[model samples]
Target: MSTSIRVIEAVKSVNVQGSPAHWANEQGTRFKNPWTSWREHDWRDMYYILFKHNRLTPKAPENMSTLLPTRKPTWNHEGDDAQKLKATWIGHASFFVELPARANTEGRVPKRGARILFDPIFSTHCAPIKLAGTARITPPACALEELPEVDAVVISHNHYDHLDRPTLTKLAALPRKPHFFAPLGNLAQLMSVGVPQDNCHVLDWWQSRRVEVDIPSQDGSDKTVPAVFDLTCTPNQHGEGRTPMDRMGYPKSLWASWVAREVLPDLSSTSPKTVYFAGDTGYRAVLDEQNEDEGPVCEAFKQIGEKFGPIDLALLPIGAYAPRRFMSTVHCSPKDSALVFKDIKAKRAIAMHWGAFILTTEPIMEPPKKLKEACEEVGIEEGAFICTDIGQTMLYD
Candidate 1:
């Protein structure tokens, strides 16, 4: 078989080295987390912190119903309406997004728009096994059966919390199988779960692909128009692995943020909407022994903002960052997410990866609370950074 390699930002080339190997920088070093040292002492310290400082228990019972209203999502399958964009939070890092197609006045119904799912996890537990893993503290916003037919699914990495096999298996069996997009080393995992190889699209940081969907006119006419969107695998400061069967596999099946932008056929028109999905990341300086002044995490976001930003909506993580010494290198706090929102120049931002799981020491609601304070401190408008209920759908025109 041919080897798989990708060059990111024209600076790093990562090679997939099979099950035992992970994607690495040009110099063959695995991706490194800023402010984190994975030495033996660091491992011991993390365990000590996890046991002593972390609050693994939820404040309330997990069976409690969500306060957010749950609704049957209405999906525009064709590219019939150009003005509509809707997103629903399923819990944690999962989001159901609907992108509108160009409006067709001649058809009786709007054309089928594109439906995209990001980091979907519908399993009862976000762990390796249902009986011996981290059980969800709250129920999913919508049942799998309630989900609309999806056109594509984007995975951020191969961590058990983000890449639940049960959910992927269920998705694979759907009548209308959605294409799966993942980082370089993830295709094998998806294929192992029975997802057809043809449906998988693997990319590396800065790599992009264009997807075209057909939209029908509203008047029930036979006319169909095509809507194209670009999906880019962007960078995030995180690591990946499902278990310790092999080495830590930190950079295996690379972790990433994703950017989706509409590609209008007309060159003269203003750029279409752009959405930034920060799968999971930390806001910290990338410590370089050689160059202490270089902040990899901060610089990556700034570069993203400069390249493909003025983002319309930014979905950012705002939890799992307690006892900063341990989690800060992998997860972002509410304040950190606020900085990311600013860095990306997002018009509006939503807080996710909290309220659904008790993964850290902070109270369940602390992220939203801190997010509000952070945004206010940064002079962001009152409603600029919002948190929705698990099942709530936010529409942007």
Candidate 2:
């Protein structure tokens, strides 16, 4: 039986042990949460919720897309500016980021900065089936076809919501397939969708890899340099599995958050830029209704801050946490996300994981409003953490 919140498993804090550290500790085939101190409900408890508890369906506003309109992004793919960074929301946890151009290679090639897609699911539904499932409540900011050539696609986990096969299939067929990265045991998931094994990279926690993509030339010429960057698989508090049977059976796969840092040739003080994607994570179990912070909180965020303090930009989840008892294990509430904003020492943050779908009982508009209150409560600076429209693009200098 899993340890109850009343009892302490006393999960010890872990430091970065550069990889070769396999996390398949659960009988050498299954993975477990390293940061979560306790899970309030187990399978049996959830069985009760499924059959006995009332599942409140949320009501979305009639003008959801109108209120949070998607704007077609006008991207500068020239890759000329070495100091410009751009981020565009593609709904949910999906985002497109352009790291500054590879240093000192401005005129030699059409080096459109290292472009990355984070947890991109451009399909109309985020599920295993096409006809039914959590249909996209808001249209993608732009079609997947409209995206610029990408260098890497960073995945948080294998959850259907995060790793849509249809999207992956289309991406793999691109003229220049983007390198795909995810946590351990997920290589097969990518492969199932026809991504060549050579194009896939799955890592254990703290494992890092440097990926480079050849930039297109200005005159469509042959001579072009590559944009380089390092992507690190980081730990977080979350569970995995797509179907009910898979959830019941544990010898399952791994889940994670990710860190991406540019590798510029010029080793100047401002050469490297770092971006953190929380993907999906919970700060605490929220066991204490009177005081959520007093519960056993995940410590991984603090470690990430120590390793990569002052992140340039962080895309964090800020919704789908209505009934805290169950959702708090894998999803973060708006208040919980506010704590994450500080824990990672983010320079700036854009809220995600909401507005794209109505997955929980919380009113559709509550996440952003509550996030504002939480930020103010925690003394977070004004504008430090803000919510953007589903397809809005924000540029960083």
Candidate 3:
């Protein structure tokens, strides 16, 4: 046997034991219950449906044009900016947030806010091609080495896209490994990939831990800077998985969205501007459970608004949903995203999870366009939803 084939077999063998049970029991890795239930049809069944409907556009594995590399960004800190926040889209589900420069205000400059990452997928493909049956259409927008510094990383669920092994490996090996956060059962996945325990922080739904971020004052200001900021783990309607067969139970690891805000000294009536990061949620009936438990999604938002006040910026998913019958329950389409925006009462939001990886049946450029039109129809300002190309960064002052 060839040496390369032998190596490939060895790697596959190691992972096989840890593969999800659903795939193990079925012996067919191509189908999943969640995917099937959402579609009301199996993978093969969908193929036939598409063929019959004349929607099959089977193209060769040629490189997709839009999947080109974007240029690195420049961070220019001019004048006295008040703790600026800038976000760079580093491809699918990955972003880099730049904390403002720490300047002395009171007596000392607050520790510049810690950098945080979300459901990061730095690898080329989400799932193994042998399992998913397709490779990623686009490469990651930025390589790990290119990242400035990450202080914390949040794992939304156990999906390969959200919990990529290669990405975790690279992240774990950083000179100063950032604090890793995940749901309950996910520690196993991270350990399996070689991340250490001291660096990991796991949380259940609605749980929060305060992390200190140094508050900066104007460079020449004589004021003493604050000492920290806080990050909270909120809830989301999503699922988790490592293998096809592993039914550790959906939402087992406590799938969640996140809220990050400045920590006020008083912690009294002074409300800090909130930033919500929606991590791949489908609208669930439980969303409204917070109030009288009526309108799930809307109610969830109402509580969030009351607690966090008007959101200054929200990072929400706006793609990967297609063939509505299968995706609506688990993923929100562009229109559904707009509704979520209204529910949350966020001042502005950015559309993500699109144009990075081709994980569904929708065409590449459909998400942003649809979101824009939907926002317009709803009488929202076009600028309310910011959609930029991969690697582009936007500042919310």
Q: Local distance difference test, per candidate?
A: 0.71, 0.77, 0.61
User: How many Å off is the CA of 309 in candidate 1?
Assistant: 1.4
Q: Taking the tens digit of each residue's C-alpha lDDT, what string does model 2 give over 59-114? A: 56789878778888866744434457788888889999988765444545444677
Candidate 2 regions with alpha-carbon error over 4 angstroms: 1-28, 43-48, 52-54, 77-82, 105-110, 130-133, 217-222, 249-251, 266-269, 288-290
Q: Per-residue CA lDDT of candidate 1, range 236-315, in tens?
A: 77777666653464355577899888766554254588889999887773221434223434456775787777898889
Q: Which is the better candidate, 2 or 3, if ranked by TM-score?
A: 2
Ranking by lDDT: 2, 1, 3
The root-mean-square deviation over C-alpha atoms between each candidate and the true structure, in angstroms, is: 6.6, 8.0, 11.1
Per-residue CA lDDT of model 3 for 1-397, tens digit only, reads 1000000111111122234332223333222322222222346445644564334323324555444446565434454443566677777777666555443333344334446787888776777664332455566666778776666787877777777888889889976667777755577777777778766767644456565533334354444354344566655555665665654333334456777765555633434556788878665321212331233342344446566657787888888776544455456778777877877778888877776555667776778889988898776777987786677777776
Candidate topping lDDT? 2
Q: Give the least accurate 10-residue stretch of model 3, judged by summed lDDT.
A: 1-10
User: Which has the greatest TM-score?
Assistant: 2
Query: What lDDT is obtained when candidate 1 is compared to the true structure?
Result: 0.71
TM-score of 1: 0.83
